[model samples]
Target: MRVFTVAEAKAMIPEVRERADVIIRLRANLAELSLTLNTTGESPAGGGVAEMKALEAHLGEAIGWFNGHGIEVKGIAPLLIDFPAVLDGEDVRLCWLEGDERLAWYHRTELGFAGRRRLA
Candidate 1:
C-alpha cells in the first residue's frame, strides 16, 4: 500500500515495462502450449509438462517482481499495471498499459481502468 509520487512512478516505467514484456512473452508461450495440449489430447514430447511448469513459475516471478515493488499487475494478455499514488492529496492508481510510452493515466482508488483519466 505504499504510495508513490508521480515522478517516482514515472521513473519506474522502464523497469516495469521490461518485466511486463517478459511476462507477455511467457504468457504467449504458455497459451501456445495450452493449444498444443488441447489439440493433441496429450502432452508434447520432451517434457512439455515440465516446460509449462517452468513457464508458469517464470511468469509468476515476473508478476511478483511488480508486487514486491508495490505495483499492481492487473492483466497479462495486454499487460496492465497500476502504481499507487497520491494525487491532489487523494489516493489514486497511476495506470499503464502495454505499449504506452509513459505513465499517462490514473483513476481513483475505488475505480478500475475503465475510470482512468489522463494525467493533467
Candidate 2:
C-alpha cells in the first residue's frame, strides 16, 4: 500500500477531480440504462447489452486509474476516495468526496467516513 503525505495527496486533487467527473457521468449513464432494462424486462432493441458492457468497461477503467495511483475508491455515487496517509505516526486515510474543493477530512483506517475529522 502506498502512503502519501498530506501535501502529496493535496497535489493529486486536480487529476482526481478530472477522473471523478468521468466516473460520475458514466455511473449516471449506467444507472439510467439499468432502469430502462428493468422497466422493459429486456435489453433495448439495439445493442443495449453491448452498450451496458461498454459502460461497465469504462467505469472499471476509470476506477482502475485511481487504484493504479494508490487511491482507494470507497463509493461511486458520491465519489468517495481515500488516500493512505500517516497522521500522528499512525496510518489513516485522507478523505475527499466528489464535490469537495480540497482534501479537508480524514479518519482512522477502521472507522471509515463516518469517523472523518477535519484535517488540522
Among residues 3 or more apart in sequence or in different chains, the pairs in candidate 2 whose N, CA or C atoms overlap within 3 Å are none
- The per-model lDDT (C-alpha) reads 0.89, 0.93
In candidate 2, what are the lDDT values of residues 36-97, reduced to their tens digit? 97788566656577888999999999999999999999999889999999999988999999
Question: lDDT by residue for model 1 over 1-110, one digit each (tens)?
Answer: 88989999999999887887888899998998878876875566655778778889999998999999999988887999999999998889999999999999999989
On the 0 to 100 scale, the lDDT of residue 82 in model 2 is 99
Please give me the total number of clashing residue pairs in predicted model 1: 0
Q: Which run of 10 residues does model 2 get worst, by summed lDDT? A: 40-49
Which residue runs of candidate 2 sit more than 4 Å off their true CA positions?
41-45
